[model samples]
Target: MKKIFSFLFLQFFVFSIVFCQNQKIDGHPAWIMQGNIYEVNIRQFTEEGTLNAFAKHLDRIKKMGVQTIWFMPINPISVVDRKGSLGSYYAVANYNTVNPEYGTMEDFKNVVKKIHKLGMKVIIDWVPNHTGCDHPWLDSHPDFFVKDSTGKPASMFDWTDTKQLNYKNSEMQDSMIAAMKYWIKKTDIDGYRVDVAWNISGNFWKKCIPQLKKIKNVFMLAEGDSSYLPKSGFDAVYPWHMFHVMEKIAKGTLNAWAIDSIRKQTEKRYPANTIQMYFTSNHDENSWNKADYETFPGAVHAPFAVLTQTMAKTVPLIYGGQEEPVLRPLKFFDKDPMEWGKYKRAKFYQTLLELRKRNIALAPNASFKKISVGNDKAVYAFVREKAGKKILVILNFSATEQNITIKDKTLHGTANNIFMGSTETLSSKKWKMEPWGYAVYEY
Candidate 1:
């Protein structure tokens, strides 16, 4: 009886191990440590709008400690029912072909090589939920598309420019997976930023991720915020809630305590291993809204950038023109090139990026403890620590300078101030914070 029980126990243990392995996030064979991601809007990145033109900036990006580069759709756009003059990149005409407007296939390969040469991974946006009407599959395999009750091809949501895909069809899933694999095989690109990932069924991602993993280790990022996506196969999801919280704070609708509440809520919702991609502004936010500066009024730019870097379970993202403090809404379907110029904000980002790379405590999963929220509605204070290293960050969300008193002794120590570039000694006692200012100190 004892021998039989031992055999059964062993069998159950083996099954449990296999089950856990199969459920791993994004089908990543291994876990990632601290990583910084950069978004590339290839169409608007340069005047030439070619892979070669973007290649020139690779060295600079590498220097910024960027671990991954996410390119917006490189696929050819549908000319039929185009949104604008240039058409939306999301309107996919051909999944496999590169947009002639951006560059040739060879040019994309060279760009991928250059990115890999710098020891950084590249991911392209995958719009799996929908495709442009001009997609060849529509003609070849009409059954691959979703049909409405009227027996017409369905246009899911208000996306009249894009036709929804039918994930129920195994062939559609296979074709999408094949296209993903093609990019990996041909360009050696690392992974994908699945657009509107929530719109697709989790089962499809589960089936697709494992296949992609067979090619190479890939880091999958979902544009939507779904915990199950990470649990099933994605490495990270957007912190849409955090962005909303920040925007509220910027608009004076919420106080600093709201930020703390949101952080705590996020911590409770996500797993310890899952990464939240935090950003001040991305292409959508910049293009739709008036950029971060306009959206986040009275918020000091440098400190806001620093806050994202120090936040827990975060992978900070830099949109194309953020470093330059570009305020204009970039033309989505037109040749609206960024007017590159020297800005103090650029220096601020450089310093923060350097600090983030050097500080192990700032790495994802390092301690992110909210120390105190000042009685004053505008002040938010937190401490991040790892091993023996600790950083205390205090930000005054309001425009007017305010005095703050630190009642916590743990924060009282000799530390380097990232913004002022000096050493500050804090005590268990009180200190005043400047308006729209932040103090990042390490001990």
Candidate 2:
């Protein structure tokens, strides 16, 4: 009897192990596990700034190897207490409709269809934490908003153009979920990139995300980095901490080793397989802060960008004009069309994007092992491996050259340099890396 019981127990344990191995811990859509996201600031993508105009570039963008397209808020902007000639995208006036400035609702639907036909997923910005002051909810359901000391709807922070939503009201929460559902059911959009996601109640996301997924296997990305965002059903969250560290490294205030600390902290803070959206710049960083040219500046940008793309559990993001290599700060509340000059950086990105798509080692669930290549202060080296595939990435963060040696005997082998398109046998011989240089190898 004891022997029979032991056999049964072993069988159950083996079954459980296989079941866990096949399941995705992050709950992200299968398409996103190895994909990269591109932020489309439709307002500035083209001088026309219309959905139809943006459609003209679909083939070009598709060829660039973008897998997921994240459009900033497409809803109409509120005119009441508007900040400038054009209002903020986050000040959403309506949830169910498209911004007239960008074109009609049908135009956006057509664009989504085109994006899908091109084999890329589309996810629009969703503002659930607040609404434009002129939103009809202000009049139709005044109780849906948070009231101030004066008993009037209050603005979120100092953005007087927007009014914060009252999540405590169960009816409002239901309404918000319904609005989110309308997009999936009506437009066939793949998912949403929730704005100010941390500010919204985690309970709301827990309630909202499942319903959206029920309609389709939708991807959900939260703008905030709160650990609860992942627990609340977010497939990806902003890597605000690592992004800041990248900036500090570029400015020479921090070193490449700083990245490891962030990696360790993130592992401890979130559940296993939690994905982080990594980027050098986004809409906020471009407009409110500064462009990557100013933040990362020159050659330094390449290494950090490589880090974002090749890092473990990363779903890299390339803000619209980064390939255009937009150098100046984009105007947030007005027309600031992108001057796409010959797409100077297109090939540079294509190499990275395509590599991630084909490389199992760069998959979001791949295992990451830091390689000690010496000079931790100025150089970052790591290896990603999965299913017998291995990718080694080395980045020199400083403006000065780095001479380092790979001491790990296991890493010595013949590997192809994906960027240089060269094959070389690497060993204990010292290598001289250019200033702010980056390299990726498939061994």
Candidate 3:
């Protein structure tokens, strides 16, 4: 009876949140259109926390079907007022060079070359909003930093280890753009994942991004969900709004259809061609909140992972150690390395990513139509169709059995069970999902 009441409550939430809309997209690089993203937290990626050490896992990552690798900041950290022993990656000491803790300039270049040789694009994390307190610019160019009301270097939030850069300073603006350009010119990296993108003014990005693009057809991802960000020149932005709803869904505080409502809200705000980076976990999430395992235990994660990868206008992100299924909170400002167990979820991610690469229906620009299976609450279903191919996902958001007969004619076709690796005829209509179970079929 308790389970029945809980399920009923979930259904009520689903009805309130379920809705839909589709947005068109453009200018997403042709190569990344169907690719999946992998974020590497260099400090915790390996015990060594060095570029040379992290290089050894390229083949394993490539085999996982990841196409783009977004590395967390590789710059020297500030020792002054440091948050922890190693300090935060966002505390950039130099905008133009590699952190010695990782590797030398030449070694970093070789690693980048190797990643390219394997046919994967690499984008480094760029902290454009601030610089470490010990940055050379702090000593030589006092006007480059944002000063507080007292006319002293300012810090973001309570981050005393770093000083914020003043984009209002025109000379500082040019220097920042030149430093970013220097990376493209030197290492030939694919692009950047800009940090605190919303904090910086649109004009600075308006001026800076175009200059970086001039050097190369770079892929730019903003660490923001602002609609203005995509308009400014970013290839993608964080789907924080959707991520919050997803967290609710994971905790059963919301229902599956909440995704539909969030998706609609997000689609209406951004222009066509903007991608949202969807992930179960990232550096900040792992370091601050509980890891995905703790947040969405067992079956709660698979369906969300499926949603992240196959949702319309999304590029899925796999944080390091996710394949290992990291179970602990990784220390943010220190060398609390991730454990590389027997690569438990490697195949799980491989299936989802490979499906994205091969299925046109999963493309960021493709059409996504939500399907209602059970009484609008218990079952959340959707279909992705493109170029004569279709993929269907039906998930049970509850922790009990759900039996629903999908009446939608659009889903009436033969499908290959993506997880079970068997043929399934949707003509039967009736389907059963175990407690927290998910069903995915591709046709």
Candidate 4:
């Protein structure tokens, strides 16, 4: 019994240490806590699909209150076994240069300068886990690639267009880090949104990211959802688990109560300071899967977008053209530019962005408390409070109207509906939420 007790104590100590890892984040930019990222698919952002073409839209993007712009891979794509006429952006062929297809390196530098002139930070997509088959290193440094059964370089799982990089070589790690530094020095980019970050070894990131930070105190976002990525030096990681659960709820495979439970589970998975990038749609969702039109159609998109904007330890992302409500699946390797219809949803997103900028309670470090109301199975409600400011959010996830009454003191008192511009005495009123409807009240 004494031996069992001693072993249990040892296990508890180890578990506690491991659980506390993500809570002690340092070196992350202070500006990120309240940031809203706009992921720009440069190829589809405009008809020209060039760096110069995209440059013209910077003024409008900045006017929308976006703090950061995440540009997709801008490096040349390898033509050897390339997927389509344009090839996947992830199949990077060059490390230290811009893709001529986009424009000359001079044009990219000019674009970065213009973005900085507008006081917006730009982060390019960094592909580190793999490279295109035609990468020069394939011949000069064959050891940089993962070997197949025949002892030649191998492409990762049906990604015949690209080759997986071998992380075992220390020289390869140094070269990759140097290449990452080259971009910052050349383009003065704010940072990187590392692609397939978890596929590479964590130790390599532990070495590389700190070096990158020394050159510039930049924010790094990992494509992976694992807590290890955050620990390895990424400022934020994807919240794919929550995104999948949300899709399930939209399909009626789960109820609104699942959100409360899932929120708890997600919190347990990360440390106190871990920032998760939350979103309803992204590059993959917009192309590979359905856009918001199919999955979170109509009012369904609003509540989920609200959840991302108000959730704790999260930075929301809006893919380019979301404001225009792009209704089709964007082709990954083809020139299917978004038709910029009248910016109908521009004000809607602008309101959310401006609210996030002005409201301290909606920041990532604010206090979040779940509030239960009538129709608990269909209504998801919560309050985010910071200092003396409180914002109450009530979202009806079901496809029918929900008559909900507030019994909690959090909703008591007069508050303004920022969206509808109406004042309500919420202390005793029963409210009806339209199907897939949401309301935000600020006091």
In terms of TM-score, which candidate is strongest? 2
Q: What does the lDDT read for residue 191 in candidate 3?
A: 88
Could you tell me how far off, in angstroms, the CA of residue 180 lies in candidate 2 after the best superposition?
A: 0.6
RMSD (CA, Å), each prediction = 7.5, 7.3, 13.3, 10.9
Off by over 4 Å in 1: 1-32
- C-alpha lDDT of all candidate models, in order: 0.80, 0.91, 0.86, 0.87
Q: What is the lDDT of residue 442 in candidate 1?
A: 70
The candidate with the higher lDDT, 1 or 4, is: 4
Record all residue pairs in model 3 with backbone atoms less than 3 Å apart, i.e. clashing.
24-272, 25-272, 25-273, 26-273
- TM-score of the candidate numbered 2? 0.94
What are the models' TM-scores?
A: 0.90, 0.94, 0.92, 0.92
Candidate 1, residue 15: how far the Cα is off, in Å: 29
The number of the candidate with the highest lDDT is: 2
- Between prediction 1 and prediction 2, the one with superior lDDT is 2
lDDT ranking of the models? 2, 4, 3, 1
How many pairs in model 1 have backbone atoms within 3 A of each other, for residues 3 or more apart or on separate chains, i.e. clashes? 4
lDDT of 3 by residue, 1-443 (tens): 99999999999877643321011137656668888889998878888989988999999999999899999999888888788898989999988888999989898899999998998988999998999989999999999998999999999888888999998899998998889999999998988999999998888888988888776778899999998899998999999998888888778788877877888888889997789999889988887888587777877888788878888888999988889888888888878987785898999999988888898889888888988788556577888888888888887777778987878876777789888989977874576778777878898
Task: Indicate the TM-score of model 4.
Answer: 0.92
The C-alpha local distance difference test score for the whole of candidate 4 amounts to 0.87
| Number of colliding residue pairs in each model | 4, 0, 4, 0
